[model samples]
Target: MKGRRITMPEPVHENPPEFLRNAAEPVRDHLLGAAPLPAFLHGADQLSLEDRRLLVDQALVLLEQNYVHLPLKTAMHAVNPVQRLRLLRRRMERQTPQTMPREWLFHAEMSEIFHSVRDLHTNYLLPDPFNDKIAFLPFLVESCTEGDRTRFLVTHVASGFSAPGFEPGVEITHWSGIPILDAVDLNAARFAGSNTAARRSRGVQSLTVRPLVIHLPPLEEWVTVSYIDLAGTARELRQSWQIVENLPSFVSADRDTAVSQGLDLDGDETQRAKVLLFAPRVVAQERAAEADESLPDLGAGEIATSMPKVFRARAVTTPSGTFGHIRIFTFNVSSPGTFVAEFVRLIRQLPQGGLIVDVRDNGGGHIHAAEFTLQTLTPRRIAPEPVQFVNTPLNLRICRRFQGGPGLDLGPWVPSMEQAVETGSVYSGAFPISPENGANAIGQQYFGPVVLITNARCYSATDIFAAGFQDHGIGPVLGTDENTGAGGANVWTHDLLSEFLADDPGTPYTPLPKGAGMRVSIRRTLRVGPNSGTPVEDLGVVPDELHRMTRRDLLEGNTDLLDHAGRLLQGLPPHAVTITEAAPADGALHLKLAAENVDRVDVYLDQRPRASVDLTGGQADLMVQGAASAHTAHLEGFEVGRLVASMTRDLS
Candidate 1:
C-alpha cells in the first residue's frame, strides 16, 4: 500500500480496500441491533451474591500473595486494593439476595479496585461478552502542538465509512457536549496509567478504540462530534459505537524461549483493531503475504519485509542526511531469535550512516526480544534486566510447584525467598531473565549512530528495551513524552495461573463462577548498568531528549519527528568495523579488516584474548597461529582506548 503525502485540503488517501464494504456490513448491523448487548452476552448464568463475593475474594488472594508491586502501589498511590476488595465483599454480604446487582456491575466494581493500582499488567478481565469484543469508532483522533496550544486533529478514518468534511486533518472541537480535551481527561481518570503522560496518551487512543476484555464497552451508544472542516467551517455529526470481534492470539513463554515477558493485552488487541479500521488494505495484504510468503506492496521508501506487522522500515532523506528509519509497531512475536535476526538483516540493507528506531505505541511483547535486540546496536556486553518476586509464602510454594515445568520456573527465586524468612527481605534476590550469553551471542550488528523515538504509549517490553538502550550507553533516546508507560513486570493470565495451581487442592485458586479471569504482575523488573536495582515500575526510563508532536508530524508522516532524530544522529559520531576476509592458511589465520574512526582492533579466539592489531589508515591485516583451530572469533574496535564496535563470527 502506498502511503499518502500531505496535501492542502484533500483527505490523506481514499483508496481503502473494496473488500471492507462487504466485511464491515454485518459487523455494523450487529452493532446497531436493538438490544444493548448481543444474544450470546445475555446467555451467561447470573452470579449470586455469594458468587460475586467469591470472585472478589479470589482476586484479592492474587493481589496479596503474588502481586510484586503491591507495596509500591500502596506507597505511591496511597490506595489499598486488598482493603478495598475486602470491603466490596462485606458490602455484598449485607445486601439481600433479591437486591443483588447484575454480574457486569460486580465485574466493574472489581475492575475499579484493580485499576486503582495504576498498573496495566494487572487487570480484572470481564466474562463472556465483554472478553471477546471491542468498542470502536470509524476514525482516530490525535493531538499535535501548534506553538503554545495543543490541537486535536482527525488522523485516520476507517475505509467503507465516511463523514463528509470529517476527513483527516480536520480539527475536533467537542465530543458529545464536552470539550474534546476535557473528555479525554475525564476518560483518562478511569483507566490504569502510572504517569500523567501515559494517562493522557491512553485517553487519546481509547477515544477511538477500546478492547472489551480489559475494559467495558462504551456506555453511550452514539456520540455527536463537533469539528471544523478544511474550510474552517463548523460541522457536527453523530456516530454510533461499533461492536466487533477481538481475538488476538498470545504466544506463551517457556524456559527455552522468552526469559521474562511484559505484555499489554488490551493494547495488543487494539493494535489489530486500528489496522482493521484505518488500514484494511494492509490487513488484506498481511493475510495474502502470510499464506504464500509474499511481500506486501509498501509505499515510497518503505522496505518490503516478511514481518510487516512488527517492523516498518524506510530509507528516509531528511535535511541532515539520508538515513534508515524503522518503526517497531509491537514486540508481540513468537520467535525472539527470528525477530533479532530479521532486525539485523534490515539494518544491513539500509544506509549505514545513521538509523532511527520508532517505538511510540509499542506495548511490549517478549522480554527476550526486547533485551536481545539491544546487543545488536552496541558493543557493550548486554546485561538483561533482572526480575524479582514479592517475598511471600504463597509465592515460595508457587515457585517450588513449577520448578522444572515447561512453562515458568520460579525455582531460581525460591532460594532467596526462602532465605527471606530469616533475613526479612521484602523481595527475592534479583536475577537476569535473559541469559547474558544469549543476549551477546550475535554481538554488535549495526555500528552507525542510532537514535530511538518513544512516546507515553510505549509499555511493557518496550519499556525494558528503552531502559536497556539508556543503561548500556547505546545511543540517544528521543521521546515524544517525558517518559514511557511505566509498565515493568511479567504479566501472566489467570488461565495460566489456574493451570499451575490446578493440581494443588490446598490453593485457593479455582475457576471463576463465570468465564471471568484476571491478570497480575507476577515479577517486577529492575534496571541494570548505572541504574542498577532501580525498579522500572512507576518510574519508567526518562528520555535524553523530548519532542512534542507537531502539525506536520501528524499529517506528514512524522516529518518533524524524523527531522529531530536526524539532527541528533548528525551530531553523534559514526563508527564502522568490518572483517572483510577471514580464513585459515598454513596453520595460521589470515584476516583483512576495515575500520572507520578506530585506532586498534582486539581479537579473541574462542572467547580468549589472542592478539591486538594496530590499525593504519583504517585498515589491518593480521596472521595469528592457534586461531585456525578455534571454534569462534570475536572482534572489538576501539578508538582512543574506548570500545565502539564489536562482531562475532563462527569458525566451526
Candidate 2:
C-alpha cells in the first residue's frame, strides 16, 4: 500500500539545522495573519519546505526587532508560506546584507567567503558594521592574504596572554561555520605582533617611553643650559653638523659669545636643538617589514623639509625694463593691531602715482581688522556710527538674558545699544578719516590712483575692504563680479547649551554637531552703496567692473583681469562704463544716465517718483536720490565692466 504524503509543521529549537522545515512552521503561522509580504515573493512556488522555514525565521526576527512591524490581521492573509518567506528573505537581505571586510580575508573560512561574494548586491537594510573599524582591520586581513599571519596572530591573540607551561590539547569550536580559537597560545601570538605594529604606527616605541618636555623661562626672561643624554636612556639624539655648517652668518651665534661660553663655537645651538628634537620621533616611527627579518628604518632625513613661508605678490615688468610690484597686506579678520600695522606697511610701500591692492582670498576674521584697515586707507576719521540690529524672535532670548541678572537664571542682562556704549564693549570704533589715521610716508606723497583686485572668493574682511575703498574713492576695482556677501556678524559663543540646546533640547550633546551650535546675527550693518539708505545685509559688494571668465580662458592661465588692471594703472581707457543717476521728472524729480559699454543695466527703484526723465545715454533712471523713499540702481557693464568697481549695491 502506498503511504500518503505527510506535511509536517515547522519545528522550533534553540539551534535548528539550516534545512529544517518544522523549525519555521510556528514563525510562519505567527506572521501569516500579520504583515503583507512583498510582490517579488509571489514566484517562490519552487522553494522547498526548508527554504521556506529559513525565510520565515528571518522574517520573525525582523518583526521582533521593529524592522517590519505589520498589523497581525493584515499579515495573516498576506501571502502563501513559500512566497512570504522568499519576500522576507529578500527584504532582510536588502536591509542587512553582509559587509565585505575592509581588506582581503585570509583565515581560511573568511578568505573563501570574502572572495565568493566580493561583488554581492547590497540593499540598504543593515547599518554598515565595519565603517569605523576599516582602518584597523585592513592591516590584519592584508597580512593574512600575504601569508604572513604571524603579525596577525601575534597582535590579536597571543600578545594578551601568557604561554601555558605544559603541552596542551587544542580543540576548535565552529560558530556560523567559522572556527573559533583552538588554543590560547596561538591566539596570544597573533595579538603580540599586531599590538607592536599599532604602537609603532602611533609613534610610540614602548610603554617606557614618555613624552619629552622642555621647560622654558617666563616670557620676559631667557635661560641657557647644556644637557647630555643619560646612559640607557631610550631617547635618541640626532646630529645637526650639516645644518650648523650651512647656517647664514646672521642667524648663527657670534664666535666670540660661543667661545666665551665654552660652547661649540662654530655651531648654532638653536638649529642643533631643532635637529635633536626630531631624532626619537623618527625612531619611534620605524616598523617591522613584511619580511620580519629586518625592521624598516624610516630615517629622519627621509621626511620632507618644512614648507617655506609664503607671501602673495603681483609683479609687472614694463617694456622699458622698469618694474612695478604690489604685495597684498593680509591680517587676521578680528585682530585690529595686525590690520593697522599691515595697512601702514601697505601705505608706505605703495607708489605715489599708482597702486593695486589685492584682497581676493581674504576670509573675514575680525570686524576690528576691517575697521582698522579701512581707517588707515581713508584720509580722515569718521565718527563712530551705530550699527543697526534687527531684533528677531530668536534674538529676544539673548536680549532677555542680557537684561536679566546673571547665573543659570538667564535674564535682566539683555544687551542694548546704550548698555554696549556704556561698557565700551560695542564693536564701534573711530573710522580713520583724519591725517593721524592716514599715510605718513616720508618720501612719496600720499595722493595716488589705487586699484583694488577682487573676485568671488573675496569674503567678509575683503568685502569690508572693497566697501571702505569705494566709500573713500580710493581706486577703481578690477575683476569683482558679484562679491560673496556673508556679513551680519554671526553670534559665536563657546557656550554649547546657549547655542544648540537653547533651541532644541531633544538633540543629544555631541561634539560632532558642534555641541549643539547655534548662530544668528545680532546686528544689522547699514552700508552706504553708490545709492544711499541701502543696507549691505544679504547683498554683498558688487564690482563696478564685472569680469566673467570662460573655462577655456581659465585653462589658458589668463590673468586678463589683472592685465586689464595693469592697463588701467598705465592710464588706459576703461573697458566699460557704469552710470547710476537719480533726479526728478515732471512735478516729481526724475534722473537718468547712460553707459555705452554696458551690456544690460537693471534699475531698482525704492518707490515711484513724481517726475522722471530718461538720460540720453541709456545709463539708469530714478527719482531724486534722497527725495525718493529709496532707489537702488544696478548697472551691468560689458566684459569691460569687470574692471571698474569691487562691489555695487542698489541704493537710490
Candidate 3:
C-alpha cells in the first residue's frame, strides 16, 4: 500500500459508520499465496516479430472459424474484425525495420480488434506477469441517484489506509482533475461492454480495481481524487495503484460431474477480481468459514448454509412483509446440486411470504448451474436457453471429431451443422446448453411470490439466469439497471481451441508464445418462450421494473431497494404447498400433502398425468399407481383451475 498523501482533514465522528468500518477492512493481500502489494512491476520486452505473427494469425483463425457471435457482432457493430486483422498482418509483413515495439502495443492492437465486438467472452489474454497480476486502490466507489442526478460516493476505504475525512459516503466530484462522470466515460471507452449502460457501469467499477488479464494497468502511477466530505468540507487525496499477484482461481465442474478436464478453463477471473475489490470482508469471512467448518451462524437473520462464498442468506423484514432474502454473490461454483440445495434450505428457514433473489454484480459461471437453478422458483416447465454455433467448416470438423468426447460433447450440434452445408444457414440449429429434463427434474421448490433483482454487472450465466426467470413467467424482475451485461455466448479457452486446431500437416496451428492465451465465444445463446430464437447478446434481459439506487442503498444495507422489491412482492399472491411425507404402500404411492390458497391438486408421475384430487382439508394422503418405478412426482396445486403452488419429489 504505497501512496502520496497530499491532504488530511478531521474525522466526521469519533467512530466511523458501520458501513465505513466494514468497507475499510483489508482484503487478504496474499490471495492464493501471491505476493504483497509491490511498489513497481518487473519490466520486459520479449515478444518477437515471429511471436507477433503467430498470435495475430491464430486470432484470425478463431475469429473466422470458431467464434459463434461473429455474424451478430459484425451486424451489431458494423465492424469486420477479419478484414482488420488481415490488414494488420499485411502491415507487419511489409515493415522494413524488423525491430519489435513494446509488447503492450501489440497486445493492445489484438485486444482492440476484439474490443470492437464489445464481447467480454472473447479476449486476448496477456502472458505471464500481466496475466497473473491485478491492479487496485485500497477503496471502492459506487453510485446513487438524487432525483434526476447521479452522484458517485466513496463507499469503501481499505483498512490500514489513511484517508482522514474522505471516509465512506463522501461524494466524489472529480478524478485526476476531470469531472468524475467524464473520467468514467473516458475509461469506459477502453473496455468492452455490449451496451452503453454496461460500458459506463463497468467504467465506474474499473476506475479503482482492474484485472490486468482484460485491462492494461493505469498509465498514471497514481490518481488525484477530489471530493466533498460528510460535513460538506472539500478535500483532495492521491491514491497509488498497488499490484497483487495470483488472483483467486475459480475452477468449477461441468454440470457438477467428475469430468473436470477441459472445463476449468471456463472459470471467471474478472468476477474474482470484483469479489476482491467490492466485498473483501465477505471474502475474508468465506475464507474463515472454509478454514473452520464448525463456524457459528452469522447472526442478524443470516441463515446457516454450506456455500458461503456463493450464497449469503438472511431473513429480511421489509415494510411489505418478512421475506427470505438471498444475496447470490456469484454463480461460479462447482456443484449446482449443492448450490440449489443450499438455496432450498435457506428459503425454507425464512417466512414463506416471498423471496428476493439478488444476482446483482454476479458475473456468471457454469451454464448448467445457472440454468438448473431456474426450476426452483416456478411451477412452469423450465426451458433452458438454447445455444447455437456459427456454421463454419472448421467448426464442423471440431464437432465431428469431439462428438461424445470427455467433457466436450459437440454431438447434439453435429447433425444440424452437417445439414447447414446444404441449407446455406449461417448458424446451426439451436439446442439448450443444459439438458431440459435436468432443468425440470427438481420442479418448484419455492412456492411463495418471487422477484429477481439484477444490474448491469449481471453477465454470462447470470444473464442466462435472468432471461430464464423472465422467460418462464416465474415472477417480476426488478432491476437497478435497464438491462444485463448481454454476454450471451459460451466462452472457450485457447486450450479448447487447440483441440480443434489439430496437429496435422499444413494445419494453421502453433503454440501460443510464452504463456499467452485466447478465449473465443464458441456458442451464442437464444431466448425461450415468447422471445424464442432471439439472440441474448446485445439484447439482454430487460427488467419488469426499474429502481434507482437510493442514498440508503449505498450507505445503508440496500434498505430502500429491498423495500421497493418487497412492495412489488406484496401485490402478488402467495401460496403454500408442502409435501410432508411420501412412501410406496402396497402397489401405490402415499403422501401427506399440505395446501394453502388452493382448492385442487393434480398429480403427475414422470410428467404423465396420474390423478386429480380435491383439496378439502389442509392435508391429505395421495395415492397413484406405478409409484415404485416412477422417478419423479409432480403435484400442481390450483385454485379454481388456476395453478398457484407446485411441488415435486423423487419417488425412487
Best by lDDT: 1
Model 3 TM-score relative to the real fold:
0.89
Better of 1 and 2 by TM-score: 1
User: Could you tell which candidate, 2 or 3, scores higher by TM-score?
Assistant: 3
Predictions in order: lDDT: 0.82, 0.30, 0.77
lDDT of 3 by residue, 1-652 (tens): 1112112122333343233334423443243222223333445456778888888999998899889888888987898999999998988897543565677788778889988888888888887667866777767888899999999998876654567697889999999999999998998898778888789888888888777777776678889999999999999998767665533554432333321111112125555555665656555566566667643437698876666667888889999988989988676666666677777788878778899999988878767778888888887888888788899988888778768877657788899999988899999988776878888877788888999999988888888999999998889999999998888878787765664556656556578987888878888889989888888888889999999998899988999999999999999888767778878888887777889887888888888998888878767777776675678878898888877779877768
TM-score of 1: 0.92
lDDT of 2 at 99: 40
Candidate 3 segments exceeding 4 Å error: 1-39, 95-98, 252-270, 296-299, 404-407, 500-507, 580-592, 605-608, 617-632, 650-652
* TM-score to true structure, per model: 0.92, 0.33, 0.89
lDDT, candidate 1, equals 0.82
Clashing pairs in 3: none
Please state the error at residue 116 of candidate 1 in Å.
0.2
Candidate 1 residue lDDT tens string, 1-652: 2122111122111332232333453133222321223333445546777777778888988899989999999999999999999888789878988888876677778889999999999999877756767777778999999989889999987756666698889999999989999999998999998899999988888998988888876767778999999998999988766566653453544533333668877778788677656765555455555666556567888777767667888899999999999888888877789889889888888888999988988999888888899998998999999999999898898888868666556678889999999999999989877778889888888889999999998899999999999999999999999999999898876667777678887877878866778889998999998999999998888999999999899999999999999999998888878778889988998888899999999988888998999899999999988677878888899999999988888877
Clashes of each: 1, 90, 0
